[model samples]
Target chain A: MGGDFGPGITVPASLDCLRNNPDLKLILVGDSTILNQHLGENLSVFKDRLTVHHASQQVEMHESPSKALKNKKDSSMRVAINLVHEGLADACVSAGNTGALMATARFVLKMIPGIDRPGIISALPSVFGHTHVLDLGANVDCTAEHLYQFAVMGNELVKAVENIESPRVGLLNIGEEDVKGNEQVKTAAKLLENSSLNYIGYVEGNSLNAGNIKVDLIVCDGFVGNVALKSIEGAAKMISTLLKEDFSKNIFTKLAGLIAYPVLRSFKDRIDPRLYNGASFLGLKGLVIKSHGGADALAFKTAIEIAEIEVKQDVIRRISEQVEKSLTLSKSA
Target chain B: MGGDFGPGITVPASLDCLRNNPDLKLILVGDSTILNQHLGENLSVFKDRLTVHHASQQVEMHESPSKALKNKKDSSMRVAINLVHEGLADACVSAGNTGALMATARFVLKMIPGIDRPGIISALPSVFGHTHVLDLGANVDCTAEHLYQFAVMGNELVKAVENIESPRVGLLNIGEEDVKGNEQVKTAAKLLENSSLNYIGYVEGNSLNAGNIKVDLIVCDGFVGNVALKSIEGAAKMISTLLKEDFSKNIFTKLAGLIAYPVLRSFKDRIDPRLYNGASFLGLKGLVIKSHGGADALAFKTAIEIAEIEVKQDVIRRISEQVEKSLTLSKSA
Candidate 1:
């Protein structure tokens, strides 16, 4: 009902997640006939842990967010999110149109008190394991206040998910210098500096992947964050393409590639984007993870695992308390 | 008197350029003693083509752009730009502080007739040869009008430097849809659409390095452009580091790496950043190129070659004419 493959990908990914986690239960929200067809023969095997919540409609990948929000009231994405809001489900995961998912999530789940907007936070593969980045196309034109909120949410996510007591949060800017970025960034820096969070001042774009400077969370407006994330993806793609083309250019290189296959495979595994597939919609009242639309079964399973982790960690409650504390501190001051 | 290596890198790079292009003459502007020391006994060998123009001061790498413009009037960076202003040189190339160089160039040569601000354009290695992107940290807070000017300048640059009659100009955004980006980007897209330039609507960040979509020039605000460029550099660095670590994990992998050395070298050579070292300051009355601050002798020579090409192609004059024509057309409409 979502993503490129719809039930074809999600059904199998759900089964894999159930296999990996004994306590996990999944309610596939889509046309019951198709969901049951995919969940075939195994229906009786997993009947206790798996169920189908029939949805009347589906959202297209290219559909406008507002249009989907207005028309697709019974879409699988909407039904899944509704289950979360009704307290029937701990979290919702979707590999669907990003804009539509976000719009519907905002409309249905609403925002957490003291938070103005919902930010999409995702972990990117970095030198030291990985670093979490936020506001990845959630709100393109964000105010300084919105950016400060993003920093807070990103900080809490890392603290809860990664088990860090006090995560070092860095505001993404063009330069480390105090005078380097635009007015929005400068104001946001001031807000983060005064806050009680472990703010680490400014970090440049290169700091995102470089190991020299360690940062737990990188915060920026959605516009800059989206551009930076996509640029990294493009670079990784270009490097892989170039490597393949070079290795297959002739017979000699092909032999060398075959010899070096083990080392190359390990390298690819370390930097694989699929391993870091899930993106959380933070600042919302309920947990919702967005998997890559073109993700395979393994990648989508990763997204489901991320959702399970967040729910177990009570990420929503932690972020809500932090936002309330910061707001109260500012008001009293 | 600029960059990390100063005359040590620039002097040798200048000699290499002089050796390669017999018709080219270079004016080395810095402290006479240091310049002569680096020039060595070669001063007599290329005496006619290379000469030192003494400057009393040097702009430190960390100096503020405004401070450098005001207090360092006799700085080497300022004097070199002054030479271009007075028509003593066809173009100026510097491995100096970007802020100092851009500020001094703007102060001395000023902006072109119909352009509001100067943009920094550099070529990025893409699947289809290379793509030129502009406003790479020149104006962090740009208006819609400023973005339009960047498109015009970037368009003119590719036309002159790459010899493309009509470069496909793409406005960099988070999404390709008309309603997907911020207000400024949306307004700028309209301006580009109605203009005479070959505007190809909006392009996402992945389009920057992806080969599927062919774009000659990508235009965005300086803040976005700088972040995108640095993100690519960070990703490339991360991939290379991972490759190195993977190849040296064990004796078996090390042996395999040795066998694959030739293929790896060719891959590295194809994506080397040195080949695209120079970034032009477009929409200025005179030409100035900024080389990477940590560039080696070989990389510095590439910057000089870029400057030579721009001078020969009359990029400044072409940009000025294009700006004037666009302004006239908009006013009439």
Candidate 2:
């Protein structure tokens, strides 16, 4: 029971994914009764590929991280993560309270060696393919050292998932200028410059979305990253809303909207928010994908896709090896 | 001499503004030779409304703030700000180096009493109306006190410029939850709660563009504000580009795009980045509008319109008085 629809949306999406990918198997962990109601007649069809593991407790969105961790011993989110921890599943995906999910996942899987805290990492649909941005509200008050580590993990993640030999890492800042930013960003820039990564110096937010992607991976503190992510979401929504409003203003425009519906729909599909749903909890020992709490069936399916790709690429092993290498290099240099 | 295009764009933009607004008088500050070349024979036609105030030096974009202040005594940016300082112009507008402009403007006009650093405030076209956001790349690493001050300045700006009494103020954070942001944002939330302003508490980045318009003024430190601003710009561009690409995929879609071109054009015009060109430097003794460095004539014209409105409203005086009153109320409480 996670996200707004809880098991209602998750169950159907998982069933769909399992049907599409022949080798995929899913363990649906939630209130078995509620999930069964949604899966009603379809349970028999997917019985061979799916297992229903019941968890009585659920984490509320308002619950504090520590509170949820202490009280909810049998939450679906926790049990799901436990499956990954015990090596029963390759990865787990959840559409639950972010703080609760992060706290529980960190507690169960633990951090990769040399990783202090697992960061929230997600890919944004940029003009040129996708840009991976890390620490999306995982650690709001990040230090220079934390930012540098995020760059290392994010670099390795893109290399593993996308098969990019050396992904360009960018330190996100207010401006492109070397002198323009808070003390933490400036210090992080210095660290990134000396590190054995393809550091692209400083990148502003516009560069993140522009089709001619300047940097493959953008790194910043959770606060900045989260704000930037949400801002892009808001802008895209507002623009589309404005277009619909304009098209509805008159009969002529309405006719035009009708004639152009196919093109508009195709355009909408390209920039659909659902396509970029899951955010990985990088630096964790096991793969954990956090779907948006308000995600629907389609968005949840996209989140599951992230898990499928990550598991296929062995993202955890790659991130682990890179972290160890970077740590050793830092100590020596 | 000033921005990227120098007098080529600025001179024509000023001329257009002068033609539109009869009461407007413009003093073009830059190299006289370049200004005359751009102005050509049009100088005689606009002679009554325009004057050329030449400055020999120009501040490059990469110049350090301190270096620009000390070395560029006769810089166009400095000279333009001096006109406002000497009561020759009600406000000064420039598209020059931001750091140099801020340093020169602050040194020339000084800050209002109880106001620390002046914030770069601008209007973003939101769903409901335009929302005012401030400290956009002014003070990157700000304290809670500084954030509170930005709220006061931004609140006053919305009131004075937009004529909205008791405009709702929001503290921008990673999440709307009171516990979600860094320590600085948390402390600032408490301060805003206690202040006399109509503080609506924390707002996330999506809320900024979402037409619901929770608050009229969104306040944050410069770093977060800048990133949010750029992210919106990037997303808008990306969405439009994707829409065009979708339309060009096939013959039927191309015809649909042709039929819907007018409605699409109007929609694009509504959210055109040129319309939101000027950013006000608030909490200073005098008004100063910072135009985009790469702004074209149309965009620079919009920036000049901002200066005209602020000057007409006596924004500086109103901001100073309200800031004093707010500070006094806080001290007593």
* lDDT winner: 1
lDDT tens per residue, model 2, B74-174: 99989989999999989999988899999999999999888777799999988877888987988888888889988887887788788988998988888
Q: Pick the candidate with the highest DockQ.
A: 1
Worst 10 residues of 2 chain B by lDDT: B206-215
TM-score of chain A of each: 0.98, 0.97
Largest TM-score belongs to which candidate? Answer: 1
lDDT of 1 by residue, B64-178 (tens): 9999988999999999999999999999999898999998999899988767888889999887778888889989888888889899888988999899999999999998887
Q: What are the Cα lDDT values of the candidates?
A: 0.91, 0.88
For candidate 1, lDDT tens digit of each residue in A116-229? Answer: 999999998887778899989898888889999999888999999999999989988888899899898999999999888999899878777864688889999899999999
lDDT of 1: 0.91
What stretches of model 1 exceed 4 Å from their correct place? none
Which residue pairs in candidate 1 collide? none
